[model samples]
Target: MGNQQSIKIFLALMLSTAYIFSFSHFGALAYNTLFKNTDAFAAGTAIGHLDISEKTAAEAERLLEEEVEKWKAKTKITFSYKEKKAEADTALYEFYIEETLRTLKQGQKNLAAVDVDQEVLEEMIYRTSISLGTVEIDTKKLAADLLIGATMLDESGYTFHLENYIPEAVRKSETISKATVNAEGSLNEIKALLKKMGTVEIPAKAQFSFLRLVEEKDIQMHHSSALSIMGTAIYQAILPTNFSIIERYISNALPSYAKLGYEAKVDEKKQMDLVFSNLNDSAYSLQLSLKGNKLEAILKGQPFLNKYSIVKKDEQSFTPKTVKQYNARLESGETQVIESGKTGLLVKMVRKIFGESGELMKTEIISEDFYAPVHKVVVHSPVEPVQVTEQAETGAEEGEEEEQETPDSTTDENVPMPVPGAHSESEDGTEVDEEDNEGDEKGTEPQTSDNTGQGTDMPAGEEK
Candidate 1:
């Protein structure tokens, strides 16, 4: 019994020692993974506005060097609003791209330090703002955008709208696209509601929903016409931007306040909506203005690399059909024009994108719409009543006979906006599930951001 007890104590002591050793060894391994030796960045990680996920230290260094070289080649950023204009060259300021990559740590976020000449930019901003009758300038925000844009290696443009400087942050950035529609409406009740909506900001890779806006605003049902006109203006504004129109529809009849082939009809009860997604790498602001005889919708953001032109073409008109009617009191074989007919029409809307040097980059058809015409109906008295029998005459006298009616095969065919693999629904037709979550139709993907006020965290390494 004594020997057995001693053996049991020895086994227990060995098990405790093994347990402690194993715990210490694996704990150190876990610590290395979380803090020290893990060699890859977390997914969706960015280093100084540069996405360097899954990149080793060497790889990130190479990427940062390449970006710096590209930026050195194209680092000009222009600014303009209305008549005020200014230009900036980031290369002259020399943002710290090399310093950013030098401190890259294994498995961590690294934000780059961008150096911008704020004093000179402030002078330009002041001049531009004063010219526009504004005195305030947000030099920090402008500098940030400029720095980030510099790292992006593209020559873009921005606006000096004070709205973004205000406490409310109006969210107007660069002026990407704008469109104006000369329209006047009598919906006075909705003017206040519309005015309450000062300015709308669409975030990067976000969508603008018309019906959802109205519903959130708690607009009354009677203001649908005003909403539709507003929606039309928004659609027109988006037409010239890089933004993608997802679900736009036209009414069966054209609207009086909207331009032909440019109408976007929204019906809450019918579940029709006008939705567009901001497809760029930046956020955008949309402003609606109501002047004496003008209703304008302007989409403001960083200047798009290309310009867009909305064109209407290929208009084909069809002759209206004429039908005859028989009247007993009229003279035989006499035909009267009961109703004047109108011609049917179909139009194609195309969007043409042009380069900065005025060269055509691409041309895409937005939609094709066909409007039906009113048929011409005529009344006629025929002289072919000689074949009628006495029974038929008696039945006609007893009001039992019916008159023959004319046949019609005319139809209106409207083709909607085409999407990835198929076409969208026509006028007041079925719904296509194309909201373009990423604007992929235009090779656009949603840009993921950490939203860190600064570009990203600084990387760490042995060199640090």
Candidate 2:
């Protein structure tokens, strides 16, 4: 009995010693991981448990540097961070960290830093016996949580100047490509668009321009959809001589809105048309035609608005009075005569009487295929004939004509001012064209010519 008791006591003593040794070893290992070797240096104690790692502090500088590099590459700004330190438990983790970061990147573009003074206190409990090896820690979740609080700055750190982001090239391309002006549009339409842009308050304002150069050799601009072709009218800045080339140039620059189920077409003079319809039905078909000095717009059925018409007499002029007069004539079922200096237009209205509705709508100006002399008569002849003569004489004199200065060329700058919307001011803030300022001495009788004012059924606004 004595021997057995002695044996039991010895065994108990050995077990207690083993437990103490193991606990000491485990505590030392846990201490090392928590205080000296963790990423993000997360050294914080929660409840009675102190979760800490020295590895976090060691990697703090490297993490900051990495973040700085990332921001530099992605944006136009750059940043840097400085190393900061704090003890456990009593230290302020967020304030200290933020302060340290702020000092490191002071006045450095958009970079800001925060100092996190961490306060960690560790408490441990262990059995009195047994030998202990290193304790394996599960750091995956902890590391992720710590990383949430850390940030870095880099090379491309700078103040944001939003205006600079839009390059001059892009602005130029957008301005020309997505012009708001429509061809042969009415003054009302032009005014409406400009008003939408708040031009009434700030007249010179422009909307955001969107332009994209496509890889395809040719690009088609559809107004609504591709299923059918339509009309597109544009009010553009064009010289009389450039009428032919301008058409082709515009066709290439603009995009088709046809994917949305409409096509655009440019009409004679400076009008644009957009047509919308489905393959099976003409019943719900509609045409949107734009015209006038301010590029006003109108809509009509396939062949409904063809007979009665109000057309522009000149390519480079915007006459609001003329447009209003045209509208009035169409309403009264009267034949109106529009005389602009020497340009004479005889507008005949074809009244429509639908059912018992007394006088139905007269006509909608679908496309104005009208061209007339700039002056009713020049001292000797019409404007076109005179231009033809000038060309012929120039062809004959070729080299000699290049050196000769005609009276027309010398006093061209002395012409009277032009009406608004009809002509813009020249560089010297003056209207400088005599052809627009014809007098009684130029011609008395109106020139005779075949008017192309007759409306034709053009395919909806599909640009060819």
For 344-406, candidate 2 gives per-residue lDDT tens digits of: 222222222231123433432222222122321112011111133576677777755344444
* Clash statistics: count for each candidate: 8, 110
Q: What is the lDDT of candidate 1?
A: 0.60
Count: clashes, candidate 1: 8
Which candidate's lDDT is highest? 1
State how far residue 8 of model 2 sits from its true place (Å): 2.3
TM-scores for candidates 1 onward, in order: 0.47, 0.25
In model 2, the Cα lDDT at residue 13 comes to: 100
For model 1, residues 42-154, the per-residue Cα lDDT tens digits are 66666646788876667767887777776566655556543234664444456565677666564555556567776677665554434333435566776676666555444
Q: Candidate 1, residue 346: CA error in Å?
A: 1.3
Alpha-carbon runs more than 4 Å astray in model 2: 30-40, 43-58, 73-233, 237-464
Each prediction's whole-model lDDT (CA)? 0.60, 0.27
